[model samples]
Target: MFYERFTFRLIFKLLFINALGWLLIYLILKTKLWFTIAGLSFILITSVYTLYSYINQIRSDIKRFILAIKTRDHTLNFKNKSTKGSFPDLYNSFDDIIKTHKDIQLEQDAMFQLIRTILQQVPVGVIVVKDVKDDAEQMEIAFFNEAAATLLNVPAYKYWHRLKQHLPVFTAEIAHIRKGGKRFLELKIQDKLIQLSTEVIPLNLYGADYTIISFQNIKDEIEQKEIEAWNRLIGVISHEILNSITPISSLSDTVNSMVANKEYLNKEDLEDLKPALQTIKRRSEGLLGFVKDYRLIAELPTPELEFHSIGGILQHIHVLMQPFAAAKNIRLQVGQTSSKITVNVDLKLVEQALINLVTNSIYSLEDTENPLIEIDYRLEQNKLFIDVADNGKGIEPEVLEKIFVPFFTTRKNGSGIGLTITRNIMKMHYGSLEVSSVPGEKTIFSLVFNYV
Candidate 1:
């Protein structure tokens, strides 16, 4: 509808040109005058050429627009764009396209810079490598952050081979692993021993494969962690030994004074020594028991692997601990699950671990008004979890942190290695023990195993 005026103008111009050409031809045929014919022929050729140029103007403009787009020349613009012409909508469409493209590019560049800045600021090293175009054997470094260069203690190289020459071990690790993995490696780079935590990730983008390698120097971190762990362990051992020995040492002095006070009197003085002597014996045995429990946790045997029925384990634990729950009037509920669900684990060790958890749960429920313990299994995200949850006096955050420390206990009579041994057993079975507590609400201990 908008081209109506354009079409009318085009038809009028065609008719005028046809009429002028016919008039020139008629004069040449009828008059037979030489000068007149020559003049008419010149005028006719000029009019035809002028008409061809008028039609060709739009095609030339279109060609220029396409060239500009191909060259990414956003500055090329139609100087006299009009709303009225042959298909007037075409006048500014090319300019609009260039503007849109420029906007998208600007946004993309801004986002890329933002991401680059973040990578540069982070302490962890990040490098992005991709296969060369049409060359699978060669790789190009698409991204290398400041942290990566600093961590490796080398210049940021753009090509993979150059970088590989400097860090052969790290490069080999990234090259060999196709899928993602995390590893802790001790590398000797530039005469310095550095421990690195490296993680590799593979991604497919725009039909091209890329490898993202992230690493961090963890030597200092590992040393710090070891120191902290040792402090906690030594602290626990010292507190337990002192708690036992302090009373024993004081009582020994009192017994010596009593013996000296009466060298003659027999039964009465001996009777007084009996309580002190018994007290020393009791504390000594308690300390010895603490040492034994610590040894049990420190020297756990590797689990002998076997596939055991999940339901069977739960059934056995429920039957064994039912009496303890009955004594406390705590309802121990075993969730119903398919007997078909089984796990690859050491039956004895796993059973012992569960028994320890359930026993702890039983104790935790001692003072609650309505006590309950529930044991259940869930298969989630390719992992098998056996959850032991209790409605009881839940563990406090501070106590929970130290519960797995050997001989660290809140209960007066607790040996405190129960959770430690349980956790060790799970580790031996290639599983993990995890606990979450909500002080007044509930506590859950999850035995996590990789589902096969």
Candidate 2:
């Protein structure tokens, strides 16, 4: 009803303007009078001007609304809110439109600032750039974070050419892989050697090509890891050497005392000497075995890569170890798998790793009531995992931590190098060997093929 009333008012205004227009024209054509015509002409001009002003008000308001948005001036407002006011809906709509646009702009600005703050605060150096010329050397740096400057020990560079001059060798490596990849670089900074781990990523955002280079100074991290590795190796080696030498040292002194008191051994003395000699022989052999294991773990060979069906490999291991499990009355279950599932890995190395895991499971089941070992494959997040799981007395948490540490063992006569050698083999194949165990329920050792 309100809109109908407004439409009616517009019609009335148009009719009034038309009537006055005809009247003024008729007076000019019929009378052509001097004083009366002048007075009537003035009224005609006033009526036409009023009509134009009334219609033009809407057009003028539209122009003002657009100008407010163009200039981003939020202060501009339509004051009339009552239904009685002219074009009340138009005024209300303008206010709502401005508010919506203002909110959208605010949200975009806030998001951009949040990302900027995060990138600036991160420890990894970052730089986003776009190629201005054919070569990457002539590039424009779009985003250079604070970490970039700090890690390089240089001022923020806005162009690739400027940065190239500052760190020529580092820049060269970056140029080599403008597409995308990762590498570790050795560099000298202020007469000190540092290792830098760097990566590049290429992207096309909103029809513009961009490259983001992220790097970090990993010298301290690498050095710290090396120190920890040395400490572990030395500690294990020392412990093993002492364990063998302690018994032999004490036995040697007793045997020597016996010899010093006698010219030759009588039957009683000879029997005593035999057992002591046997102990010395056993300990000497144990020490020699430990050295061989040390060499095996330290000198792991590079994996020979080949694509092999996962089902085939698992099937082979089952056939080979079935007898060993059968002897202990344990079930060796190989899970059903897809024939198409395969991985790029060394056949011998992977088989060896599985054998080690299965052997450990077999040993764990010696005292358990109903023992079972399950071999299976799982696909997760674009990677394949081959698992050897067992239901036996599982590994304890304290021992699990050191299970991969070379020469660290929980069982008597355990060389303890099996797991370490297995882990090294997976590393050579760009994969990983992982374990998880519950105290009394289950233990799972996964040989994860990550790169494949």
What is the C-alpha lDDT profile of model 2 across 56-93, one tens digit per residue?
88778789899989988878778663254567777888
| TM-score of candidate 1 versus the correct structure, residues matched by position | 0.75
Please write out the lDDT profile of model 1 over residues 1-452, one tens digit for every residue.
Answer: 43585578678778877877888778877876888778777876787777788679877978988887788777877646545456556666767887887787789989999989999999999999987667654788899998889888988898888888888888777766546766667888778898988888889999988889999999998999889878988999999899999999999999888877564858888898889999999999989988887788888777778778888888888888889889989999997644778788888888889899999988888879889999999888768999999988899888878887766777767888888889889877667899999997999999999774
Best by TM-score: 2
Clashing pairs in 1: none
Q: How far is candidate 2 from the true structure (C-alpha RMSD, Å)?
A: 5.1
The residue-level lDDT of candidate 1 at 100 comes to 83
lDDT of each: 0.84, 0.86
Off by over 4 Å in 1: 1-71, 81-87, 131-136, 159-178, 190-193, 254-275, 302-328, 339-351, 377-385, 423-433, 448-452
What is the model-wide C-alpha lDDT for candidate 2?
0.86
